[model samples]
Target: MRMRASQVLALQSHFESTFTHRLKVFLAERLPEARGALAGEEGLARLEARISVARSLGFRGERDACKYVTLSFLLGEDFHEAHWAAAALVDPRHRTPTDRAEALWNAAKQRELDEFTTESVRASD
Candidate 1:
């Protein structure tokens, strides 16, 4: 079934509001904490700490929650990568949306899964 342009646009808007917008806000707010966590601990301690921070934001949907969790793992890494990447990430920047979204994709791909994610994979195996 093909989606109409209107439906596609609406879905885009929904993701913008629910996942992207909230994530950017949360990242901005908790950046320092995320940076701190980079050096604090590893394994479940760091992963759970990131999830705990996400829970504090009150996101309540499957897609949003999934994004939050994945991003929780990637945020610190993404921040550092984006700092050096060709993607110019800042306000009043060219292609901010594309740049940021692409950065997240790269981050997700490059992330080293925490114990929770690894356990799920192992369980499935």
Candidate 2:
């Protein structure tokens, strides 16, 4: 089912807020040497690249933003690869934030998901 416009905004807002908090904490916990990387010229270039790739994904939620930045900053992956992996985690329909959420929601509602989840519930008994 297609989500309402308001629902998309609400979900994206939650995603953005959560990402901001987690990104702050993640940055804080890193060592001085690591933090310094983000402060320098090379780090700035890398961060900008990540942001660009994230924009291409067309999902403005926190996860997409964080995934791009996190992979580049922490894992040291290149922009294209990190974005591709992150894109796979979300939806590939590159247009609006609502489209991404609706694609994910529809995927979650699939028969395979229902069957897979039911097995976990049965195992708990």
Candidate 3:
């Protein structure tokens, strides 16, 4: 069946709204610490904006964009620009957006592990 342009637009809008809500719920569940920040109307707006920024940064897939938002919460919004390893994390050599996001995520985890190990050593000293 051929749908009119207005009908197609409405369907697209509805899908976007549903997808955004689902992403919010998933993020809230995965990031308990961010529950407060991800609550209420303002939170939805922030999430939408972050998703937009993620897309702008080459996170093409919804899941990849979600990962980007997760990274923002975990590593700070400007991590790509301000992190000590920012150059490597955002390097254009990655084959795809998924690869770049995965690399960034792994690097963030390694950074946390390194910090934790360093702190432990200092505490034992």
Candidate 4:
């Protein structure tokens, strides 16, 4: 489901450590109902677009995007796309150097996960 711009803004407003904790709970509450509605590439694309919009609207931090991407991936969305999106959002040009480094680290880890998932999928096929 495409989240409204206003809803995204609301999320950004609460992008703090406390809010992050709360958001996790919020997602946990809604995940079961929403997970089945989003599947495959379409779901991945929507999530990427949502993060893009959040950034464009001045959400200038990696944590929230990272959390969202992590949650989405855990919920069976495309981890590869989510990983890249999170990486790009925290890129040095877009965020602090420390954040960039962290994002790069996360990107590397996600890449590893992606490779594993790809290999596993191929094996299954």
Candidate 5:
């Protein structure tokens, strides 16, 4: 039997809600600092907004989307517009959202490595 448009939309909404909740719980479990940072309605709304932004940026895969949100939480939600990694993410040569996401991830990883190396050097001084 064919489903009505309303039914299809309802089903899609339910799926999205479920996925969002699952993502939130997964992030909370993996990032303990988020336990207090992301509590109740306001936090949920903020997370949902960040996920929406991630999807718009072409992070359709669950893992990539999660990474986007994680970075947003770490760097601030507006990081896309201002962060150094934003250069990699918006580079025209990337040619695809997945490519942009990968570039962003690499930039973030490199930044982490650079910070660690700097801290190590400082410690040894």
Candidate 6:
């Protein structure tokens, strides 16, 4: 699905909130090269395009695509290539360090998952 402009802005906000200036600059340097590769042809190309532009400018990779996707979920946002690229850069599983924003997002996401799991278990029972 095509992402709304508001959603794009929100993702940008999250991206900015999650990284430091130095990391942002480093990501900016690497982003242009990874743009197309990161944003594969899929749902919401325009929204993905906007995110690619943001990453091209200076968005840091948090780890790999999967972790980024997880982070996006944790943030209560849709997954995008920029998040994946950021995740790839940080290697979220092993050595990725999270800031306060990431921590908050993660906590919220874990709570949501826990709720879902609990509901599912209760249903099965």
Best by TM-score: 3
Q: How well does candidate 6 match the true structure, expressed as C-alpha RMSD?
A: 15.8
Sorted on TM-score, best first, the list reads: 3, 5, 2, 4, 6, 1
lDDT of 5 by residue, 51-77 (tens): 999999888877788888888887778
Off by over 4 Å in 6: 1-40, 43-59, 62-66, 70-97, 120-125
What digit string (tens of lDDT, one per residue) describes model 6 on residues 1-125?
89999999999888755443333344334555443433434423433443454344233354432233334433423332344334544444534333422543464566668889999999999
lDDT of each: 0.49, 0.56, 0.82, 0.55, 0.83, 0.46
Instruction: Locate the minimum summed-lDDT window of 10 residues in model 2.
Output: 103-112
How accurate locally is residue 12 in candidate 5, as Cα lDDT from 0 to 100? 80
Q: What is the Å distance of residue 26 in model 2 from its true position? A: 5.3
Candidates by lDDT, descending order: 5, 3, 2, 4, 1, 6
lDDT of 2 by residue, 1-125 (tens): 99999999998788654554455456547634457665656755655566666667564665656545554564454533444344544544545665554443344345346778999999999
Task: Per model, state how many residue pairs clash.
Answer: 0, 0, 0, 0, 0, 10
Model 1 spans > 4 angstroms off: 1-41, 60-63, 77-125
Candidate 5, residue 125: the lDDT equals 100
Q: Which candidate tops lDDT?
A: 5
What is the Cα-based TM-score of model 3? Answer: 0.82
**Per-residue lDDT over 16-38 for candidate 1, one digit per residue giving the tens place of the 0 to 100 score:** 45553454345546665554444
lDDT of 3: 0.82
lDDT of 4 by residue, 1-125 (tens): 89999999878776643443443445546665655434455644555565554455345466645554444445444443464755565455755544543554466567779999999999999
Which candidate, 1 or 3, has the higher lDDT? 3
Worst 10 residues of 6 by lDDT: 64-73
